[model samples]
Structure formats: C-alpha cells, structure tokens
Target: MAAFTDATRVRSDGEGGFEADLDPLWTVGGKPNGGYLLAILARAAVEAAGTQPHPMSASAVYLSPPDPGPAAVTVEVLRAGRSASQVRARLSQKDRTCVEALFTLGTLAAAGDPRWIDSTPPPVAAEADLLPTPSEAPGTGLRIDMLDQFEQRIDWQAVGDPAGELRGWLRLPDGVGWDPVSLLFAADAFPPATFTLGSNGWTPTLELTVYVRALPAPGPLRVRQRARLLTESLVDQVCEIWDADGHVVAQATQLAAYRMAG
Candidate 1:
C-alpha cells in the first residue's frame, strides 16, 4: 500500500476555531477533496470525546467550492452524553465556508431480535488484480488526481469505463497505523454514477456521504466502487469497503453534477 501524506498546517485561534493549510495535490479535480477536511474535523471530534467508543453517524454538507489553498476548520462540541456525544465542524477557505458537518458518538446494543435481510456483496473476479501504482499508470490530467488515495483495476476498460459508472478495488495506504475511520475516509469520495456522461466529459461532485460498518485493519485496505448516472447533475455511486476476509465493512454514496470539460 502506498503512503497517504498531506502537508497540513494547523494552529488554534484564540476563538474556538482552527486554521490549517493542507496540501493541494490531494484535492479532487484541482478542488480541495472532502476527505481532507473530514479527517481534520473528525480528529478534533475524536479528541473532544476522549476515548468515546466510536462515532455512530456523521454527515457533511458542501456549500461552496473548496479552494486547493490553505483553509480553516472550526469545531465545537455540541453535547457529550453518558451514552452519546455530538459535535459540529465547518470547513472554510479564505472567507467562504465550503463544508459543514455533524458527528455523533455512542454505543450500540445487541439486536433484541435476530433476523437476516437481503443484501449483496461486491463481486469477485476469478483472477482479479490491482491496477498499477498511479504513478506507473497511463493517461494524464484530471485522472491523475485519483492517484493520492486510490488504486483501481479497470475490469474491462470499457468505452464508458471511468465515465458515469465504474467498478474496481481501491486501497488506502498501510501507513497511519491503520485508522479505523479510514474506510469512512475512503467512502467520503464516491465516484459519480454517470461517469459515462463524461466518459467523454467531466463532472464535479455535488456532495458525498459514507456509512462505515467497519474499517480495514492496519495494512492495505481494499475498496470496490461503482457509479451510476441518475441525471445530468444528479448522479449516484455506491461502494463497499472490504477486509481481506471478504466482509463488507463500509458503504458509501455520492451525488455529482455532470459537465463536458476539456
């Protein structure tokens, strides 16, 4: 697994907010990626909770285009309960707020009743292989931005391959002692389903959400994703993160607006 590193600079303002300058190379399509900001806000929430079991659910809203330059993340602990905790964070670049989020921490109880529901898992290939290290792969320009966090396998390299819908496995570098939320971090950036819309064009994400049932262990984390174009700007993609054992641990969905670009 490759290393995921960012040159993020952080300092606390006298006022309960923090300012940080995260590296620009990690941005998506030359815009600051959501995972970059989510990680920072979550780190603050995690520290605020001080050993809380784990976060139950977290959501973020994208309000403006995130600048690839330095930005700020402001966090506030809303409430800490004996059984749950809440926190809010907002990400800003210069004077504009780009992302906002709310995080929840709590414990879970065993299901009073046990029942099984229909669910599907990612498909396996008879001999599926990992794609080349981003630096060694073909193509250039915007696609290069994907190199920072994912390693994909083009199952067939179709005409609409990376366009609206796509299928492939991904890995989050083994560094960072293996963060449990790394899967959530991975899920934060879901591909646009209508990749085919731009199979000959370009599309930008409107927003993204991830639900982490679990995360990869401290090593190479595998992720499989597929995107489907729902409309011109309303595209959706779903992905599942799995462990080496072939268990689905985290799932994600994304919304994006499509456009034909140079």
Candidate 2:
C-alpha cells in the first residue's frame, strides 16, 4: 500500500515545474480522484511559494481526468504578499491539460481557536459506534480504490435513510497524519452524498474549491458531506472536515456531472 505522502509526492523538475506519478491507487472509476489531484497541485504550489507552506484556498477546474502516469505541473507565481502568496498551477498528462488550479499559499496560526464561530462539527457517533466501509467497492462499478489509503467509519443507518446529509469518520494510516495538504484530500474523501439519494456510478467533478482552515489535531477526522442542489445532469456537493480537536480543518464544495443509475 502506498502511503499518502508517497502517493502524492511531487519532485522539482525545473524552475516553476514539478514531476509526479499519479498513483493508480488514488482513483475513482479508473480516473484520478479530484481531491487527490488537487492535493498534488497544492503540494507543488506550496513548494513553489518558497516561504508560504500551506495552501489556504484552492480552486480547480477539471478539464480532463488523466490516467495514472507521469504528470507535469507548471506553476506561475501571481503575487507575493507579506503573509500570503498566490499562484496558478496546471497539471498535464500526455501534453494535455488535465487540471488547472489557483492556490493561495500562507501559514495558519496553529495555536489559536477561531475568535467567533457559527458552525460546528456534525454530531457524528463515536468511531467505535460506526460501521467500517469496505476499502473496495467491487460491484458498485465506482472503483473507489482510494479508500485503501485511509481508515473510514461510516454511518450506515444514515446512509440507508439519508436526511439531506451523509456523515462519516476518516483518518490516515498508522504512520501518516493529517496536514494542510492532506486535508485537501480529506475534503473530498467521502462517498458522494448522492449515494444516499439512490444515485450511483461515477460523479465526475467539473469544478472543486477547497479552503484549508487550520492544521488538524492528531486523530481521526469527523466528516460530513451534504448535497446543496441537484439538476438533471449536475449536482453540487459540500464537504466539511473537522479535526480531533473539533476544529474545522478543511471545507470543500464541488460541482459534478452525474447520471442516476437505473
């Protein structure tokens, strides 16, 4: 099994460029997971920022789903601020643009709590009280092999009788811990909320935006994914990840193209 760090590693190829191998393990329905792809771009963006090591905000448009292979990332520094830096990154495979992203890189104050907050983590059951989802979705045709990288405990009852929301718990393997970049992956790590609505098959993300709020405390994350709206051929999904300390570590919203399974 490839660790999250190893799977998402990007090496410097040249000035403003990086090289990475898109691991096959991080795919959904044989295509790279959108969040995983965003994490890859985040890694490169942070490194290119020189001093800014965290991706504060990232907005990506998925042009194409690249296969698992060597991919190139080229980053352009848009501006360097006193506290944050902005950069644009592109991931391409076979000379075709696959993902284009704009990232705001900065550092988070890891010690302080939010001054005033209106949102809180969902009331998910304790990890011990939830049922584990299988790592492989064999018959579903979704091919969520990406689940192999993390430990997940899902609320099956809520899934069976969803109330406009899907809840779960997620954590990295024994060795890896959640960081800002990994939190990007966590934001898109859950089963689509559409699953609770009797929708199936691949929900290919058209656009995804993630905000990394804070560094996670050490433990399994509390996750809640909900559907905001759905059209005949598209769906809007929002996901939130709270750390063990009950801090909102990351949040993401995506628009995807989907078809209801017959």
Candidate 3:
C-alpha cells in the first residue's frame, strides 16, 4: 500500500491537466472510495491554485466509479481572491467522467474557539472496549480494502442498536499525521452509518460534501457518523471528526443509493 500522501499525489501536465494513478488500496468493494477520490481532486485543486494550500470546502457528485489505475484530472480556477480560491475539478478514466467537484481553497487557521457550540463528538466505549473495524463486511465476502490504510475501532454494541449511529476512532497508518487534505478522507473512512440499521449492502455515494475546519492535533481522531434518513433506496449520512484534543476538525454529509441485502 502506498502512503496516503503518495497515493493521492497528482503531477502537473502544465495545462490545467494533472495525471494520477489511483492506488488500489483505497478502494471499497472494488471501487475507489468517494472520499479518497475527493482527496485526490482536492490535492489537484490546491496545486492548481498555486497560493491557497488547503481545501476548506469541497462538494462533489460521483458520476461513475473508475477503476484503480491511471486517471486524468482537470482543474478550472473559477475565481482567485485574496483570501480564497474556488475551482472546479473532474476525474476521468477511459474518457468517461467519474467524479466532479467544486472546491474552495484557503489557508485555515484556528479561530480561537467556538462562541456557541452545539454539536459534539458523541461518546463511545473506551478503546479497550471497542472492536477493530473488520476488513470485510460481517457475513459478506466483499473486501473493504480501505481499512488496510488506517486504524479504526468500532463500537459493535452501538452497531447492533436500533439507532442509526456509529462511533469510533481512526488514525492514519505509518505515523503519517493528519492534514487538511487528509481530513477529507477521514470524513468518510468509517463504515457507513446505515450499517447500524442492519443494511450492509454496498452504499454508493451519489453526492458528498466535506468541510475542513482546522488542522488536527497529534493523536488518533474520534469519529461519529449517523444516518439522518433512509428512504426506500436512498440514504443520507452525516459525519463529524474530532481531533485527539476534542476539537472539531472536519464534518461531512453524503447521500447514497443502497439496497438491502437478501
């Protein structure tokens, strides 16, 4: 497996075009994870901006799942401002578009503290009480290769509950600390919140939006994800990631299409 930085790296082709080889280890059920693809696009967008270094917000729509191999990225700078830059990016393979995203890039600094706070990272069992997130879905042979790239502990007890919520901890492997770009991956690294409702089928993300609030402190990250609503074939999930120091670092929401396993 490649390092997260190396796996998401993109090289400039000198004309708003970037070349990247999507790593296979970032795939879930043979398709590249939506967040991983977003990270790749964010990296390219940052590089294209040439001034802004962080992706503050990214809204993406997944069109098709591309294979784990070479892909092309094209970025168009929409507006470059003194404090922020906006860009539109697309990832394509075999002449077909896979993911399209719009990103706002800027340098993020800690804003002292929140004046009014409401959302907090949900409490979970102690590390000793949680179970290691399985590499494969329970009772299914489908491989979640993405788990190999990080450390995640899941509260199985909560997974069995009727509530559509999951609490866990995650950290990058190989001592690679978390950065703004990496936080994009962290937002979607956990198992889908719908799993708590006993639906383990593949949930392909139709759209995902992530906001990077601040840089994470050194240590493992605590994560909480919940499904807000699940219709007959579509579900919406929200995820919040807090750094070890309990500061909210990132938040994300996604809508996905799913079907119950027989």
Candidate 4:
C-alpha cells in the first residue's frame, strides 16, 4: 500500500493547474474524506503561490462528495505578502466543482516563546495501552481498508456515554512521515464525535477550518474532539491535535449536518 503522502500527491497539469488521483483508501463510508480532500487542495494552493510556505490556516467548504479517481485542482492567488500568502483552490471532478477552499500560507516559527495561553492538552494514554476500535464495530461505518492505513486507539473513558466528546491517539502506518499537510487529514480522521449522542448516519461536513500551529514530531498524535453545540440538525465539532512532544500542533473546527438512520 502506498503511503498517504504518495497517494495524495498532486502533480502539475502543465496548464497552471494541479492534478491528483484520489485514492479510495482515504474514504469513509464510500465517500472521500473532507480533510483528505482539503490536504490535496492545500497542496495545490501552496504550489500555485510558488513560495513553498507551510499551511498556516485552511477554510474549506465541501460542495459534493468526489469519487475516488482523478481530479483537477485550480488555484487562484488572492494575495502574496512578504510573510504570508492567501489563495483559493477549487477541486473539480468531471468539470463539476466539488470542493472549494481558502488557504493562508506562511513560515511557522522554528522555536518560539509564548506570552500567554489558556488551552491545555487533552489527556491521552499511550497508544499501546489504549484499546483499538474493532474493525467491524456497529454504527461505525469505517472502511477497514481505510482503518488499516492508520493506527487509532480510543480513549473510552473520555467517550463515556456518547456525550459528544472523544479523545484518542492516532498516527499513520509506518513509513509515512508527519507534516502539516497530513495534520489536515488527522483533524477529520475520526468518526464524528456526535455519533456518541445516538446519531447513527453519515454526518457530512459543510465547512471546516484548520489551524496549523507547529510541525509534528515522529510518533502518534493525541486528538481530542468534542461537540461544542448541537442544534436541531446541525453540529459543531472542534478538534485539537497535539504532537508527541506535548505541544499543540493543530486545531480544527467543523460544522456538519447530522443524519439519522431510517
């Protein structure tokens, strides 16, 4: 199996656009994962800017579910500054746009001293000590093929009674390196935290925002997800990604519509 990096690699289309093969191994419940698609678009946006800035922030709206196959990414640079560049990217399949994203690219500080902060890392056990989610678990429509690509250990204590909160340890299979791009995938990789609240169908994301704080170290990442608010049919999920070194690497918030099984 190819690593996630190679599977999501985008190549120049020779016409100022980028193209990539959307592999099914990254799909969930037979649809391409939004974060995976966002990573693809972010790659195209960074490539279009020609500045090689790391992904600082990305806001994406998923218009439709794209099939696992070839897709085109068109990028338009909104602004490029000395320290950051803003760009928009569109992902199209068969000439129908499926995903649109705005990205801010900039160099992350190699080392920094914080002035003030209030957030704290979530409590996560060692990967080996945590329980692995069963591949055939009920109500979890996760594809085994996709699960094979990642190592996930659930923190069942935090997930008590499906109150829309979950914490876990997640990482790619060996040989896949960690980067800001991969962090996008990690942000949305878990099953919807709302599922714990008895929501039993696909929760499709409408809009997702991810902020990259720092480069991750080599090891499993601690992911904490919780539902901030759930209205009639809409859910707001926030996720925090902490690297092995205990520093927060990325944070994500997504708005999705909840569906119930018939």
Candidate whose lDDT is highest: 3
Per-residue lDDT of candidate 3, residues 1-262 (tens digit): 3389999999998776999999999989888888999999999999888879999999999999999999999999999989999999999999999999999999998633667678765787776677667678567678988887788898777664548888888878777778898999888888888766868768899999999988888778888888998899999999998888888989999999887766
Q: List TM-score per model, in order.
A: 0.76, 0.94, 0.95, 0.93
Per-residue error (Å), model 2, residue 236: 0.7
Error of 4 at 200 (Å): 1.6
Local error of candidate 4 at residue 243 (angstroms)? 0.4
RMSD of 1: 4.4
Please give, for residues 68-109, the per-residue lDDT of candidate 2 as tens digits.
Answer: 999999988899888999999999998999999999999986
Q: Between the candidate structures 1 and 2, which one is better when assessed by lDDT?
A: 2
List lDDT for all candidates, in order. Answer: 0.57, 0.86, 0.87, 0.84
lDDT per residue for candidate 1 within 124-213, as digits (tens), equals: 432245443353234534554645655544444542444544445555444453344445566654444354454433455566666655
Rank list by lDDT? 3, 2, 4, 1
Please give the lDDT score at residue 30 for candidate 2: 75
Q: Candidate 1 — worst ten consecutive residues by lDDT sum? A: 108-117
Clashing pairs in 2: none
lDDT of 2 at 100: 98
Separate clash counts for every candidate: 11, 0, 0, 0
Q: lDDT (0-100) at residue 165 of candidate 2?
A: 84
| Cα misplacement distance, residue 223 of candidate 3 (Å) | 0.7
